[model samples]
Target: MDSSSAIHGYVAEFEKAEQLVAATRRTRLAGYRVFDAYSPFPVHGLDEAMGHPRTILPWLVFLGGLAGGVGGYLLQYYPHVIDYPLNVGGRPLNSWPSFIPVTFEMTILGAALVAVFGMIILNGLPQHYHPIFNLERFERASQDRFFLCIETKDPKFNKTETREFLLELGASEVSECEE
Candidate 1:
């Protein structure tokens, strides 16, 4: 056809946070999955409307902490118990009490590090460019407006039908994004 091959998706603008949230809920019910919403500030209950599953970052952080704690304990145990076995005050070689501080510190460190890295990896951060940025109206996203975007990646997406669907949702304006 035309240059439609460059089309990435469609973005629908809403005036109110309520509209965005309701539109998102309806869109999900209409079987659209590959979509995202933007808002100037956190909107309560938006996550439920989006139907996003719980994240695994918490579990990852927990595992990181467990590993770090074990590593830290072994770090001291290996050196003090088997490797050198120094008898400073004739305290037990295991010295589990002293290991607690290092283990605790390592646990916190690992959890913090994993939390940051896991969030970055999960959210697909760094050096990013998205077709959504191509829309001039998107500049308002971080300021006042709210938006909903249906990406071409969704199997249910159709250019004509999706556009009409957004219009039916009472979108104030709709703009197409190009890849």
Candidate 2:
């Protein structure tokens, strides 16, 4: 599938987070895959309730940090000791203690950089447009409303059936979301 075409879904708007959560639970129980949720404020337990799997970002961050730490150590050691031996205060050329600060800083920098890039890649950021944005009322999502999107890619998704399902789930109103 084309990368940009991966976000086909219908959006349901709710006035309250609780209603959105309840509707989401019902949809999941009915074996529907919910694409995502949008709310102005953070909604507690949304991830677990939506059954999202644990992300690999932490692992990526760890590996990036480890690489940064090693790189920093080598950069310092190779230049100061191997390339040009520096014996300050009669201390050993390969002094490890002095390298701690640089290693620590690089580790943090690399981990933070990896974390940002990993999250963007994992979540598919930089999306210029989405079908749901075309819906008139959807603009409320960033104000005082909550939204639950059920993607067409879901195994149980059918245009007619899904519309009927949302209507039955106490949706104040239902509208077609098109790309």
Candidate 3:
């Protein structure tokens, strides 16, 4: 199959961050769903402009931490109270206090691991290439300029119309990206 068949859409470059932010807001207002913007640095209020919503990663990490805490406590409880049943110094086999440190450690570990892995999975990491990488101008997206890309998968995306819209929104230049 032709690699270009995986083409996502057109990318528009903006010299100023404000222009890019405004364009993102306009694109979002116009009901474009599958679009993303890139800037050399984080742009204030850009997420709101792009219609990005809060993520559930926090909840995922919380649940992971809870699971880890429960698992860690059980790991200690199972061997001591059920399997081995060894008691020293007349201490109770199900000593909850002894489990606290390990449980807390496991909770933190689980939260950290979930956060790192969840971010990776959610962001689609390990991607070696993208259609936008085909455009030479996009290289500047990390160094100097800002860019807004409207994916072809978007409901309102039309090559000509999207290009025209980006131009109307004050894009310095627009280019088609190929996969």
Candidate 4:
């Protein structure tokens, strides 16, 4: 029954997105880094309020495409030029034009695959459990409620202080999350 001993973190339930956003902003300004908010729908400007930086998934996908393109080109070039050395129609061994289609196809395939898998990796998916799931009311997050969590990993986190801060930000209810 001791609030100070909760290892998980603190969670604040908000009835509205505006309250959640404002609470996120205040938590960020108060110097907490490990925090996140969840809502039934995307909240405009919530990312800014939470101080989230842009994700690197786009760059990862681009690099994946580049690798696929080069790999595809090489797959065609190596066998045709060095392995088999086809002399059809007196065309040169290093026929750049013939390689274009496969290269383009591979590029598109790689980008699409990376877009799906990279997003999964970057977003830390396949997660089946989190401390926040301990809250029975948290199920409402997918229904209509907004929830903000300040993780114990945050440097400024103190179970009591964080709870009070959330309440001060007009949270409808503040509860401790258990790990």
> lDDT of candidate 4?
0.88
Error of 4 at 177 (Å): 1.4
Instruction: Give the higher-TM-score candidate: 1 or 3.
Output: 1
Local error of candidate 4 at residue 118 (angstroms): 1.6
lDDT of 4 by residue, 1-179 (tens): 36545667788999998988888898889898998898999999898998767999899899999998999999999999999897999989999998999999999988889999998978789888877899888999999999999888787888678888889989889887787
In model 4, residue pairs whose N, Cα or C atoms come closer than 3 Å (at least 3 residues apart or on different chains), thus clashing, are none
Candidate that scores best on TM-score = 1
**Lowest lDDT 10-residue stretch of candidate 2:** 1-10
The pairs that clash in candidate 1 are none
Q: State each model's C-alpha RMSD to the native.
A: 1.7, 3.7, 2.8, 2.2
Best by lDDT: 1
| Order by lDDT, highest first | 1, 4, 3, 2
Give the Cα-based TM-score of candidate 2 against the true structure.
0.87
In angstroms, the error of model 4 at 95 is 2.1
Each model's TM-score? 0.91, 0.87, 0.87, 0.87
Screening candidate 2 with a backbone cut-off below 3 angstroms (N, C-alpha, C), the clashing residue pairs are none
> 63-116 in candidate 1: lDDT tens per residue?
999988888889888999999998878778887987899999999988889999
